[model samples]
Target: MSGTLVVGASHAGIQLATALREIGDREPVTVVGAESLAPYQRPPLSKAFLHGSADTASLAFRTPAFYAEREITVLTGERVVDVSPTGATTDRGRHLAFDRLALTVGARVRMLRVPGAGLAGVHHLRDVADATRLRRALTGATSVVVIGGGFIGLEVAAAARALGRPVTVVEAADRLIPRAVAPVVSEFYRQAHERRGTAVRLGAAVTAVTGERGRATGVLLADGGHLPADVVVVGIGIVPRTELAEQLGLSCDRGIVVDRCARTSAPGVVAAGDCTVVGADRLRFESVQHATAQARAGAAALLGREEPVTEVPWFWSDQHDLKLQIAGLSAGHDDIVVRGNPDSERFSVLYYRDGALLAIDAVNATADYLTVRKALATGATIPAEHARRADRRLKEMLVASLDA
Candidate 1:
């Protein structure tokens, strides 16, 4: 009965179990998760779910019948507290023995530890419960203060603004998504949010959350200023759930270290998703694309099959009506080439390093995004000036290069 066991039941873990079954190598597949609900889509929790545009049923990755039909056992409402050479121990004093294990215990939202942080009306959107609570709070909220200009904060601010609530975003960095995109792209997003009546506050640090009667009232800035807030959301970032991996003395540097094959240092044990730092570069990706791909590789490794090659990392965000899609890692990129006018609300920022394409940030430019996404995935490049041409289509140009 004991065979392949995956922890977390997240996008990565679910994909691993599915992949194993797809490959017809299923001995016995089981997924254990801390959440009572099955594995569900996470990105929508910040946008569609928070905005009341989506229901709980829409968030499900797969139905209960799918798991049953696949013969995959799902253990919900169970927390795997410890991992060892052979298996894991749950919080209920249940020790589950496994022949092979996959550790996909994703990350937790990193909370603000300042005063009044524990007050009511302050929320962090990480899962279904978090979004549900935040959505409920928005029903009575008049103003929202979003701490951190990251994707989650911005999306929540947009949702609040759509509901007629005034919103303000406080960012400690000089620009939005500072570590993920270029300054030009950041400025574009700032203008987009501001155009929608969202106050964009940059380079501002929050000293504390001021509360009234055990409920958050406003965020106190370090510069002696206060921003009124009936609802406060802290989206600073996340800390990888590496406790289980660390318990077994697996290599961990902020996250569990895994190779390209998704294999951990420990034998017969591997990791994927936000919980793992993979490849030689030790890149830790949080997007669904990275999670599923790595999980597939892990499943293949578990079955002694050739693993699929990893694709270029890609991520997308839907803020307001703009669809911002990014392909590849933009870190250390030297030059950026703009392909279309940002003033028109449609363009793509091509990231280059010594004339080689590294990444692209496209907003309202899905066609251009598809082209560049494929080019980046295949290690193809285009000349800076040629990419900037208004007469030539980006896909036409990139496809020609691929043909050559």
Candidate 2:
């Protein structure tokens, strides 16, 4: 008998199984995944993996022996076609009955609908296979045109530039990473890329990918301009893989709606990962921290334990030599404070609302980030005046606040 059956053996799914085992719940746990490779890290796909510095062997989160010792059954390269309350059936006509179910079905990359988007040289980096194919195509490529100035696009551009290839980043929005960072931070990254010889085209839209003989050659812009390219990578965004949840009549909006405990509307079925809209805010987090946090909560809930998930939202991105780390959510922020120096490529942008810290984006400031992350989590307020002082250390201000 299947104790717990998890769909989509991603970070969240694997974390769920791991958490369950750590809690000493010795039950049959089966993890089903479509990818043949055991659960691997997705963040490295854009940076180290795409740059060909890291291999697939290092990408895996757990070794085969580890999973075997944990008594977890991992079924790779199998797709769960249908899931009911009692059991799920795979595409290969295999049906497995489960007492409890966990759906960690992650997100899929949004493909461009433009003309020639399906051409050979056009690519999207979502999984290992996608990165593998794109990395292969980047070999000996002279020019790369990246669509969408999001994290993935910028990372790929950095990787290609590192390989001595010319890169042009096209963003339909007025700035890069508009959905996440502030305009000031956006300009900083733009200049950072430009310093490395990357041409960033803002407020530009790609009408179509121009191809010759079924291979992408260039991109035609909405403004009637054409950029030459041997490779094109699209990092537009992603859509949650909620097909299985929705099929089972589970509530779904932008993603499968789950509570703080990662409990879905359907009984005995919990969900975590990029596929869940969590909490009362209905906010969908696409970061690895959010996925693993929700997975831990879901695992505790499944085990009838009282583990409340109250993790602060955070994310990071690696572009060229910069390591940008963000802590907390920046919503309704009324003021901004800059720490360190942006000119030197080491700084932090602190977002605040009504004297309370909202979020922080620290670049090349690991010490400041560690302090600021704790401050944000504890609702510690730092005077905006002290926060803006480039001369004073951020860590000192936090210590003073706690002492007071």
Candidate 3:
């Protein structure tokens, strides 16, 4: 009986445990997590979960009975205090020995160090408790001020608007979703949110949260501006939870470094999810798609499968009745071709560098998204003109229209 121990028991950790059990039920598997609750999907926390459209039951990844029946032992509310080459020690002071270990500790919300940040009405949604607090705060609050126009913030803003609260989003960057989406796609979301009665303040810096006796009343902007509000939701970004890895002398840069097989340099230790940097290149991802996909790959590797992961990375987000999907990786690119009318807000921007597809950002067009998704993964190159064609189907254009 080979002993496999997984730490963090987050999105990746749980998935890895399940995958291993499915591969060989006889393999002794143990999963540890800091959260008391079972693993659940996170993307919905800011949108459906917060808006009352969905609850915890709908977000749960799997029921408790599934783990019991699968023979996967899950230790919830147990935090790994230290991780070494062979195994880990929990805060309960138990030493868990293992032949293999996986780290799936996710991330935490980055907080502003400005004054009055500890104010009562300020919140950041990173977990269930955080969401619960934010939802409760909005009950008596008339207006909500969101600091940072990133995805997390925007989702919360959408939830707030859905609750009939006047929500104002303030972004330090010039455009919304500056880090994730292209400028064109960013503008589309901006327009979508704005049309829903959300006020957006761009290129604005927050100096501090104005408090009335440790309770948030408003915010002070860098430009001597102030916005009256009772609740302030900060969604700047996230910091990978890598302190445990750092302390254990594991290779960590931006995230835990893992090889193509998701194995850490430390013997008997593996890592996955938003906390890992995999594929020898150390590329980090914070999406559920990445977490689950990488977990499946890592579990197989831990079981000695060691299959090279050739799957193309994919991601999606639902907003305002629009489904936005992305395929392939977008680390560095030199050329981008806009394949449709930008003004109409329906297009796919194919990113190419050195005559190879790097990524595609499709807005409000599922067909375009699907086409580009296939093309990037299959390495099927088409004429730049055909990629930009409005009258022809992308599949037909792929071989015929590109011909000279």
Candidate 4:
């Protein structure tokens, strides 16, 4: 039997390899990662890991012995520089032949293209190495200026505040996390962060990162204002890593294009994780749940089975003591129903488009999150009027709706 080569030692890559074994595929499997460290969890890198509550040893997904027992070959510190129909060559000039290929190569952080951005105190947290450097910088940082208001930036800001360092979040948008959340949710986070002593700047643009002696000293604003900082964190966004897919003549639109089954343009190749854009809807998700589900589908496709990734996408973020859980995609929502009071620090925002439920954003409300996730998965939705009743449990309401 021919071997299967999976590029990228990411959450998707490792999960795909595991799924292959679970599904009774006994072919030779190899996973290649550019980083020297073993496959590790990434979600905590911005939160617990940066906060010093979690360490490097705790980040690994599986032990080396697990791979060895599975008879899976894992090559770390090797970068694939070339790819073709039959084989791949690493930067160290080692070539591996395979009949099936999986491209789980994830994304890279989008750096701030400004003066002094490459200075000593400017950092971007995308991987363990980035988080390690930022954690070290936070130790000596008196004040921090975060250049984006996205999840990573806000999480880092919260961590900095927890570390007793003053933080100022500069967002170019009118509110925080606008792309993924509604305006009300965005406004709530802005106030929540401000209440916790993190200064948030909305509709602010950073023109340049000013430095002194090759180290970031402050950020110069487009409005001619300057915020002093000993450390600068850039968390604008990420660009999907698709160069290898493009090299192999696969269809790429911002990311490697894949079907619901995680099958790429090539016949014997599949892809998963943040590196892929799926379906004609051009849907893309960077969450672990999506990556794992898509990888399972990719594994099934590799074995001549037709399994499609159709699970409702879910995501979560922890800021200070608040845990925000989201279910479904809220894009193109024409209306929203607010359940409970935001001041109580426990509420859910349900999104609807043309009287159909689209998504729900719940803060410190796990029941609501789970209820909506189940409802969406089963194609059931609660009425807007019924959802407005904060006193009633969403699960009860969902059951009532299903019965009706």
Q: Show model 4 residue runs off by greater than 4 Å.
A: 399-403
For all predicted structures, in order, the TM-scores are 0.97, 0.97, 0.93, 0.98
Evaluate model 4: give its lDDT: 0.93
Highest TM-score scorer = 4
Clashing pairs in 2: none
Residue-by-residue lDDT tens digits, candidate 2, 237-303: 9999899998899999989999989999987899999988976688888899989999999999898
Whichever of 2 and 4 has more lDDT, that candidate is: 4
Q: In model 2, how large is the Cα lDDT of residue 365?
A: 88
Among all windows of ten consecutive residues in candidate 4, which has the lowest summed lDDT?
Answer: 395-404
Which regions in candidate 2 have their CA more than 4 angstroms from the true location? 399-404
lDDT by candidate, in order shown: 0.89, 0.90, 0.81, 0.93
**Per model, how many backbone clashes are there?**
0, 0, 0, 0
Tens-digit per-residue lDDT, 323-376, candidate 4: 999999999999999988888889899999887788999999898999999999
Residue lDDT tens for model 3, 1-404: 24888887688888888888778747689988888888777888887778778888788878889988988888888899987767688999988888877788988889988888899899999988898889888777888999999878887888888788999999999999887777877887888888889999999999999988889999899999999899999999888889888977889988888886777777667788888877567787778777877888788888778855566788877665556778877667767777777566677877776756677777777787788777766767556655667677666755422233
Displacement of the residue 253 alpha carbon in candidate 4, Å:
0.4
Query: In angstroms, how far off is 393's CA in candidate 1?
Result: 0.9
